[model samples]
Target: MQRTRHWILRRLSHLDLILLALVLLLLGISVAVVASASGQSPARISGHLVNVGLALSLMIVMANIPPHLLSKVGPVLYVAGVVLLVAVAVFGEIRNGSRRWLNLGVMAFQPSELLKLAVPLMLAWYFQRNESGLRGKHFLIGGALLAVPFVLILRQPDLGTALMIGASGFYLLFFAGLPWKIILGGGVLAGASLPVLWGFLHDYQRERVLTLLDPASDPLGAGYHIIQSTIAIGSGGLFGKGWSQGTQSQLDFIPERTTDFVFAVFGEEFGYVGTILLVALYLSIVARGLVIAARAPTLFGRLMAATLSLNLFTYVFVNMGMVSGILPVVGVPLPLMSYGGTALVTLLLGMGILMSVATHRQLNKT
Candidate 1:
């Protein structure tokens, strides 16, 4: 019994308590918001709770694995992700005009979701392996590696996810110490190419951008979502109208109340005070992730942890921005708060990676 206790203490000492606490806190908030948003739908809330539990379990298991093992398998996993994405493009199921899912009898999944983590992991491994001798050519190669999956995803027409995948890879590149001049040059080129990109946008995509510019222009048409969402937020004011009593949500005035627009439901029920507290919680999670990355025992671990952490921040920012009408309406879900198996699984997997890195830090110190 004494020996078993000692072994448990040794393992516990390596656990990332702060990151775990943030994950649990955010998950608890997710359950509350989902319950309110779903109008207290028992089945949906229970499913989400089960998913969160699974995610936490996965995180604990991942935290115990060594960083080197993760790095070694990164490339193989990335290739598998690409193959899955390609397979989806060929024979995947289509829903709502996007062929992004594979129907696997018992469950359906999106390969693009896997790329979110796979892209970062693969790149981190690549950079760490090649960091002994960095060069412009290496940077360009990394950019190409990043761009391939990104272009494929964009062709799948999942712009939101493709952008996220690109962002994750770009974060890895930026941390690998890419040159400032190249970064500036890329920015200028992107700015200059906006016209070309705009020309190629699908009609609905164009309308989304226009809606952001003037939601009132098509009050009852393309702009209805933003218009309704803004009203929900505005009506909430300070302390909120009270949980499960939000008229916007209960009346179905706010579309996607349980998914992409879950934040609106949260804003309506919890108001500004709740919003501030929620944002603080998210920031704390990001901060803790940054700490883990900074203290990571190896370069690959550092890069992976930092990129994953920032990816979470970006998810929150983009989802809130799109829902609030500050940005073009893109179908980005609010992390754990949003309903959907793919996103929930993907996000939890990311947390798992963070836990792995944090655990590595603790192990190396001893």
Candidate 2:
């Protein structure tokens, strides 16, 4: 028992306790909500448990790695990710009108998910190399680097992932001290191109934006999701209706209740107090991530850690906003709280990188 205890303590000596605790809490809540929302279906419950285990394992493995090694491998991973994405575009499987996955003999996977990590890694590597000479030209080069994968993803018509990936890259550039004038100018240009963008959007995408602006316009059609989700949240009141007792979810009024809109089920079952707690938990995780980023020893580690922290914040903000009808429905999942294997693994992998940064710094100090 003494040996076992000592082994465990040494293994977790450099781990971020606050972040890990928050992750476990979120996972627990996810399992509970999924069980309730899914009517405690054995398959769903077991599947989620498996995903949580796998994600935790990935996190642990990543945490043990050093950030210096990750930075060295950044370019290789980025190139591989881009190649896989191109392969996806060329001969990917089409499911539900989108070509976002590649089919292996045993299973299918989405290459776009890899970009979420690779993009930031690659950008961090580049910025670190040119740390003393960052300027407008460098920013332009970074923009071009970002644009290649962004265009391919946009063609896949997965607006959500593309936007998130783009945001990830841009976040790094911004943190690298891209000028405010350049940011303002780019923002103006983007706004001016709205009409061009509107023309490029698929009808369904446009409808979602419209529905976000006013869901009542087509209450039974394009607006159904937002309407039902809001009703479910509103019905929860101060303390919620109780677990497995939410009418909107139980009776099938809520769409995508197990995935993108899972938070609605949580809100309906847990109410205002529960919602507050969930939000606070997410915020606490983000805060810890930022703290880690602020303390990272190297420029690459700092950029990568901070970008991941902000990216996580963006996911929670966008998902909750869409579900609450404050933003357009964009198919963003509710982080670890949502029921999906790929996303959970990817997110935990990023968190693992953060832990690696912390661990590497500690080792250097010793």
Candidate 3:
């Protein structure tokens, strides 16, 4: 028993307890909400459980790896991710009107998911190398690094995932001391280019944006999702409709309840106070990640940890906003809570990187 305990302790020494606790709580809540959202489907609930286990296992594995080793691997991952993305674009399966998934004979997955990690890793590696001679040119090179994959994913027409990749890369550049003038200029440039960008959006994409401005205009058509989701959330009141008793969710009014709109189900079942507590829980996890980033012993570790942490915030914010009718609906899933093996794995993998950053100093001591 003593040796068994020793082995377990040593193996898990890299985990940050606070972050783990928060993540567990989030995952536990996810299981319950997924049950409700999925209408007590045993298959879906079991699959979610399997995903949770797989995600946690990967998180542990990543936690045990040293930050220095990850720094070295970042560029390789980035290159490979880009190559896979090209393969996906050229010879990928078309699902739901987008060519995002690559079929590798025996298995298939989205390469954009890998870019969620690779983009930041690549930027961190680049910035760290240019630490001493940081200049406008270096940021330009960083932007170029980001634009390649961004264009590829956007061409896949998955604006949601593409935006996420862009956000992660931007966060990395921001942390690397990107100038405020440059940021402001870029914002202006983007805003000015909106007319051009609008012409490029697909019919469905354009409808989503229009629907956000006013869902009632097309209540049964383009606005159906937001309309139903907002109703579900509003009907929850203070204490909620009570667990699986949510009418909108249980009656299947809310679309994609198990994934993108899981928050709506949670709100309906948990209520106003429950939603507040849930947000607090999410905030706590973000806080812990930021703490780890602040304490990371290396520049690469700091940038990687901070960017990944903020990236989590972006996911929550976008999903909630989309479900609440405040933003255009997109395919972004609620982190750790959405029901997908791929999404769960990629998200927890980032958390694992957080643990790796948090525990690096301790690892070096031994």
Model 2 Cα lDDT, one tens digit per residue, 1-67: 9999998786676577778889999999999999988989999999999999999988988887788
Worst 10 residues of 2 by lDDT: 357-366
The TM-score between candidate 3 and the true structure equals 0.97
* Weakest 10 consecutive residues of candidate 3 by summed lDDT: 357-366
Model 1 agreement with the true structure over 21-72: per-residue lDDT tens digits: 8888888888888888887899988888888877766766676777888898
TM-score of each: 0.95, 0.96, 0.97
- Residue-level lDDT of model 3, residues 247-302, one tens digit each, is 99998999999999999999998899999998899889899989988887778988
Q: Would you give me the overall lDDT of model 2?
A: 0.91
Q: Which candidate has the highest TM-score of all?
A: 3
- Model 3 pairs whose backbones collide: none
Clashing pairs in 2: none
Give candidate 1's error at residue 286 in angstroms: 0.7
Error of 3 at 150 (Å): 0.4
Candidate 3: segments with Cα more than 4 A from true spot:
1-4, 362-366
Task: Give the whole-model CA lDDT for all candidates, comma-separated.
Answer: 0.87, 0.91, 0.92
lDDT of 1 at 268: 89
